[model samples]
Target: MQLEEIKETCPFCWSCIWLLVDPSFDQIYTEDCSVCCRPILVKTTISDNQITLTLAQEDDGF
Candidate 1:
């Protein structure tokens, strides 16, 4: 599916990073933090024609 680029803050490091998101529905993906070099759990959710994104800590290595 086609995706859109969005900017999100790294939950661990509070740094900015670009995210590719699926606009149709919620999605979970892993991406490493550019500033801290740690894995992040990137979550995207859409509701009421609005998109919400979040980042969290990931235990599994990527």
Candidate 2:
């Protein structure tokens, strides 16, 4: 699988950002914030061959 940074609109903050995507099974992968360089959590799913991604702050509980 290739790691690719894709441009996506932040669903929570409504901001534009780049997210890392592993082009297999459309799994949601999390990485340090590209803009703020902070930790984040990403949940993703695929339906109809379209990718849907959600981003949120990574809490210690997780």
Candidate 3:
């Protein structure tokens, strides 16, 4: 599978992290914040060789 490392700011800590993204499909997943150790919801969308990321507090409905 093709992978892309995307830099994103953690919503909880505002620290930067490199996220491994798959460009084959849209994805939603949870990951831990590296700096704050808080859960993060990552939403990814790929189009036209570009990746878009959206993050939120995990499962908090925020």
Candidate 4:
């Protein structure tokens, strides 16, 4: 498994944070903000060895 580091903004506190992601497969999960400790929804997409990360509030879709 390959791990990549990416920068993202915390949805709760709006702080810049670093996240480690595995780009081997597409995934959707929830992670807590390191600063505010709020849950953030994470969507990861892998394409042609490139990883894209999307961050949002945990309750964004519900």
Which ranking of candidates, highest TM-score first?
4, 3, 1, 2
Top candidate, metric lDDT: 4
lDDT score at residue 44, model 3, on the 0-100 scale: 89
Question: What is the C-alpha lDDT profile of model 4 across 1-59, one tens digit per residue?
Answer: 76888998997898999999998899999988899999999999999988888888998
lDDT of 1 by residue, 1-62 (tens): 78888888887888888877889988788878878888898878899968898778897422
Per-model lDDT: 0.82, 0.65, 0.87, 0.89
Query: TM-score for each prediction?
Result: 0.74, 0.63, 0.86, 0.90
Q: What's the lDDT for candidate 3?
A: 0.87
RMSD (CA, Å), each prediction: 3.3, 3.4, 1.5, 1.4
Per-residue lDDT for 1-62 in model 3, tens only? 97888899998889999888889888899988878899999988888978889999986643
Query: What order do you get sorting by lDDT, best first?
Result: 4, 3, 1, 2
lDDT, residue 4, candidate 1: 85
Instruction: Supply the TM-score for candidate 1.
Output: 0.74
